[model samples]
Target chain A: MGIAREHDLHKRRFSRNRGVGLALAAFVAIIFGLTVVKVSNMDVVGSYAAGSLTAGGDK
Target chain B: MSDTSARTTPPPAIGGEGDFADYFALLKPRVMSLVVFTALVGLLVAPVPAHPMIALAAILFIAIGGGAAGALNMWWDADIDAMMQRTKARPIPAGRVAPGEALAIGVALSGMSVVMLGLAANWVAAGLLAFTIFFYAVVYTMWLKRRTPQNIVIGGAAGAFPPMIGWAVATGGVSPESLLMFLIVFVWTPPHFWALALFVRSDYEHAGVPMLTVTHGRRATRAHILAYTLLLAPVTIGAGLTSVGGPVYLMVAVALNLWLIWGALNIRRRSEETATADGYRAEKAFFRFSIFYLFLHFGALLAEAALRPYGLGGW
Candidate 1:
């Protein structure tokens, strides 16, 4: 019985840790995804950035 | 699960190889949050509107650059950080991250942030980002921090640059409004930091950092706080006359600035003995309130920007 109880406690701890890790990952991913999606809607034709690129297009 | 527990119980970390969280802490997420928020306000409040995507990219680059600067600071300040109680738990000081590793990450991220931002936005914004990082890492951290009591006053420029960069992102240049935003933070920084120094002077003294309180004594520090407050009030109110400000910002600026000035005066009157007896209550309160003051002032600008679409903002 003691062994079984300890196992259950260990499982609970693992689950709790996994929950925290997953929550962190989800928060980061959501923010990243939203930013990319919002910017994707705008049409980007070419580089209007400062300097010129090289032979083909950009440097 | 029991087997997993046994496996996880390894010996204590030596040489601080560092975990993911340690790396994240090195980025100084708290400071980055402030940079991101203020930059967002600057972007939104500018006269020119950016495509949502462009805005997002610019902010990400700005945030990454800010975080890079923070990592560099941690690497450089690790010695002093280890010496002080307040900073002893930081990743480097606490032995969770190695100095070389922090330096490498800082340099790499700085280059990436600057270059990528140049591609994502105009060169103007990217240039500001580059300068901000260089100013923070080299000028503020390496040169000024240990040398002068005026560190916070002059180094405040690094923190004050983000809004201008954000403004540049949208407008591709600066305006009177953006300069006003920069000036407000510039003037506000010394008072804000000095108030905290009044309470934490011992920490800086122990760490060998020449904070105003440590160098000038509390009397001079407190007097400076009041003087800065007097200068700050006019600038804060003057912001209301700029394009970025409206009724919301004006009202917030006046109310908050008055409270801060009063807090400074209160602090100026108290002796250190009385302050210690009171546990630095008034100073601590002023410090806390100053944080709220900046947040509310910037928040008011954001609110004004949001209201502009509804004809509720601007002169």
Candidate 2:
């Protein structure tokens, strides 16, 4: 018996798969961008911690 | 239960063919746009400056959280959505996406967005995003929506939280300006929705949603719209004195509030007979103008922020 190359289900699902794939790719990109941005701004975290500590001291 | 019978039976197609757009539709993209715009304004007008990438990621996560809440709302309200003309074409109601799928997507995105926001920004911002999602999905959708005519009045807080969260992303806490932004949207919601409810009068009634127009009558809803608009004028104009406010915002606020009050007064004075005869022309015009009113107010805030560097933006 000959094997079929593709099923109707596969054809119908193409757009959905593409969309999911694109979304995943975008997610990875956003994560990578955020990591770079956060790493570059080490002082931001430090200042935030310092600010919180000062506020607590005042309280 | 035989193999032969199973093979012959067609696969159930209830949610079998949902395209990517169908899934996106579950996210309520229109509402997402409002969240994004307001949140971005909040971020931009903050006293503290954020790096571009950080701001972008913060907005993306906030938008995702908002959309996730919308998906959960669709899942919960699928039944009533099917009964209403405005919502009957939504993903679940139209049978393009399964309710279970929407719920799963909502829950998954909610968790992911919150955690990612925490990592990208401060935990305070992330916490606000999480609370916003919970408020919209659980407090508003599950609790208040069907129970009272004041549903949107109280539930509007969920939509109002975005700019505050955006501000938190920058300043790591709330401030007078952020709260002012929140108040503007919160107060604006009732009149905006009431105007639409006035036009789409029967959708809520048919779906058993106790919208003010349905429960209190059109005349009362009109009055409520006028009252809310009058109340909104002070809150909006008063924001001009806050850190986010500037001469530009004040001018815009004064002009827009006048136009809004005029529109609301028109809506208040018209009887249901005149409205029905004119096909709710005044109500629809007011609804359209309300969108501009909110947009321009926020836009003016952005203008003030933008002009600050050049000494032309704000007071």
Which candidate leads in DockQ? Answer: 2
Q: What's the lDDT for all of these models?
A: 0.86, 0.93
| Regions of candidate 1 where Cα sits further than 4 Å from its true position | A1-59, B1-16
Tens digits of lDDT, candidate 2, A1-59: 33566665566589799999999999999989888877767778888989999999999
lDDT of 2 by residue, B1-315 (tens): 569888999755487478888898888899999999999999999999988898999999999999999999999999999999998988887877888999999999999999999988899999999999999999999999999899999999999999999999999999989999999999999999999999998898999999998789988999999999999999999999988998999999999999999999999999999999999999999999999999999999999999999989777
What lDDT is reached at residue B108 by model 1?
A: 89
**What's model 2's overall lDDT?**
0.93
lDDT per residue, candidate 1, B144-190, as tens digits? 99999999999999999989999999999988888888888899899
Give candidate 2 regions above 4 Å deviation.
Answer: A1-12, A43-59, B1-13
